[model samples]
Target: KRMLAFVAHKPMKIPGQFRKIFYEDFAVHRDLLDKIFWNLVEDSTVRSLNDQLDQVKAPTLIIWGRHDQLIDVSCVDVLENGIANAESVIFENVGHVPMIENPKATAERHLEFLAKN
Candidate 1:
């Protein structure tokens, strides 16, 4: 259920065919998932990176979903403001995985960013 929510703009947007795939993926990766979760939970590097964000000199594009359940859209500002060369594009009515939920728009944004950068 959480996987579906993360991939889709909404739970109902999840295709019926992909439900079984997600279930199987979870079953196969449950142990790995637990390890990753615990590792990140214990890692202080995640928070410490904030102090270094301004050091990033490369152009950065932050494309986020307004409806992202896992990470709120408001956090985009942190990236945009912290990075030296950063911009953001917010996709409304979308969720965490914009590449999957709205591939066309994601690709378009990427193309635009590439052309500009």
Candidate 2:
């Protein structure tokens, strides 16, 4: 149950039949996950993006999940305040991956951002 909950916003929401397939995919992609960790997580620059946010000149749309446990929602303020032209829209019931938890709304917000920009 704990492992299932780790990948999903609410593990109860996931159909039981799909759970097996999800875990199977994780096993198959374990190597890729390890590579991502070494390439991104272990990289020092990724930890200090705040200092470089000011370098971003393009119009930025910061979409975050208010319930995200992986990355705190408070970081949105850092990006919004640091970036020259930035906007944000947070999803209340969503978790770490907004696109997976609420694809329709996420895609709609993305389209709206593109249209406005």
Candidate 3:
């Protein structure tokens, strides 16, 4: 969880001022905000996911860290097999958000993956 979990843990296209207002002026407290934000996330997830297991129609790639604290590492396997055509790469030294923490390495790894695939 983020020290600032008030905002959903994702990048955005929403206006900066508006994002602040929704997250602060309207949100009375952190606990309430966390509940609301998580609820919204769940609602949005249900809207997108029609089934528990889905099959991809195209090639897919999954990059995961072995020591991810936010989620179980086994989730990568679940994702790999769930897709129609999928493969994965795991970084042993990483925790979470490898792209944010190591852009250069992530980019290099991505370039390598693209070149090979």
Worst 10 residues of 1 by lDDT: 5-14
lDDT per residue (tens digit) for residues 50-98 in model 1: 6779889999999999988887888899889999789999998889888
Most accurate candidate by lDDT: 1
In Å, residue 35's CA in model 2 sits off its true spot by: 2.4
Model 2 lDDT, residue 14, Cα: 66
TM-score of each: 0.79, 0.79, 0.55
Model 1 residue 22 CA deviation (Å) reads 3.1
What's the C-alpha lDDT at position 58 in model 2?
A: 98
Candidate 2 lDDT at 104 equals: 94
lDDT per residue, candidate 3, 53-108, as tens digits?
37466667777766676766798888877776677887766656667545677788
Tell how far residue 75 is off in model 3, in angstroms.
0.4
Q: What is the lDDT of residue 77 in candidate 1?
A: 90
Off by over 4 Å in 3: 1-53
